[model samples]
Target: MKILNPFRLGLLGGLGVLVAVGIGQTVISLATILTYVGAALFLALGLDPVVTWLETKKFPRWTAILTVLAGVLGVFTGLIFAIVPVIAEQVRNAVQATPRLVTAFFDGTVRENVETALPWLGVQDLLDGFNEWAADLDVTTIGGGVFAVGIGIATGITGAIIVLILTIYFVSSLNGIKSGIYQLVPATKRAKFIDLAEQVSAAVGRYVIGQGSLALVNGVLSFIVLTLIFPAFGLPVKYSALLAFIAFMGSLIPLVGTLSGSIVITLLVLLFNGSPSVIAVGIYYLVYMQLEAYVLNPRIMNKAVKIPGALVVIAALAGGTLLGILGALIAIPVAAAILIVVQQVIIPRQADL
Candidate 1:
């Protein structure tokens, strides 16, 4: 065999490494944009089933898209209106309650109770230290913190708007996007690729729909129990809407979400509403979890890809480690897509070999 030229090999290897580094840097710089695009695409896929269903019912494609978007916007707007005033009122109440709480800690029955419960601990000294720390907080530091919070809020709002616009565009043109992507494959493999792609898409869409239904059921039931039933039974549940919102969001995640939300809500009830309310909430959630696992999940997710439980856990953990909540949310579907490819493409080819 002819000897390779060491210098030429080294030069080529170095160039390849440099090119990879450049691409990596570019990706890092564009991470936020990429995240927004990915989120929009995910949301679009989730909404696709509804649009298609509407189309099948004789709705014009554009009209169906518009209707879906309108409904989503309406729901979002209604939530904002419902939530904001409550949040603002809570903030105002908190600010007004702070001085009273401080007074109670130092001079009221709260101090006595704490002293009685923890005779060994220096509650006064602890309070003094906390006060000293608070006193040491400078105006500039507080202002900076406030400014940072404002900046974060603004950035979040901007990102939401960008994602919404991108989602609308993606939803409107998803079919075209799929057709364009199919063209990139070799003609010989294009049909198979399209078939696999459609299956993957359908799996993702069904998963989204199933998960959303579960979340919605959790949210609605939570709201009814907290906002209506509890009060009727003389158990006051403060921030019912907010608590329900938390339940809704948590249930959107796969395996662990509902349990996590229930635990959080139970803890909150225990802290704020005492033993009786906590007991009620805890019992309700425990029963709900059983129903969900036995009845809701199996029925709702029947049409979606049936990922192994262990695989789902592993996939969720890996995805969450890589990309946080969004990663966790999409991980199962991604795993399913890979499973499909292996089953349909790889195994058969391997068998032939």
Candidate 2:
């Protein structure tokens, strides 16, 4: 090689670093948009299997898309009507109950029970500390915090609408999108690339459907048990609708979702309805977890994703650490896609070498 000019090499390296930094800044600026697009794409993939199934039943692609969209809208509309009012009413009740709850806590009976349970703990001291802290809070700071929360809620709602619109577009044009992407591959490798890509997409679709089914099952069971069965058995479960909604949302993540939701619901039940309800809720969740693992998961997810248990845990933890809920939600399918590529391409290439 010709001897490199030191100044030129250093200048080029600096230029490269500047270009990289510019690109990173651009990426940081576009993070919110990218997140919206990713979430939309994910939802579209999840809905694809349903659209495909409708097509198999002799529905035209457009008709299938409409059918699926209508069903989704109808479900959401129904939920808004059915669930929102109950949740709102319960929330209002909770707000109204706050004063009474505080009064009861300060009353001798509740404090005595707590002090009796933990002899070393000082209930009065804890209350005094809490009161002092509350008294010391700045009104301006509190107002600012409330304003921030309002802004966050508004942003979340707007983002949700954007994601929904993008999801509909993606689902309608998914086939076209895939065809366009396939056109980019070199002619010689295009066929194989298409096959692999289709496999990965199908796997992702299946996973989303399976996970949603599990969440639906959990939500329905939770609502039924807490709202009806518990009350029938004289084990009151306050805010059952809200609790069930939480369960449904939490179960969207793999592996850890159900356990986490169960813990939260159990604790809330204990707080609201005392030890008897907690015991019932605890036992129910323990049995439910077993059934979910052995029966529901096998039937629902057997064909969707088959990653090793250890890898599943590892992927979920790593993804959760990196990107919170969304990362955890997508990690398993990403891992599955990697596995497919390794099995199909890397292993074969290695063997040939």
lDDT of 2 by residue, 158-183 (tens): 99889989998999899999999999
**What is the per-residue lDDT of model 1 for residues 103-209, given as tens digits with 9 covering 90 to 100?**
76566455554555446768778778988998899999999999999999999999989998899899989999999999999999999999999889888988888
lDDT score, candidate 1: 0.86
TM agreement with the true structure for every prediction = 0.85, 0.91
Q: TM-score of model 1 relative to the true fold?
A: 0.85
Q: In candidate 2, where is summed lDDT lowest over 10 consecutive residues?
A: 109-118
lDDT of 2 at 111: 61
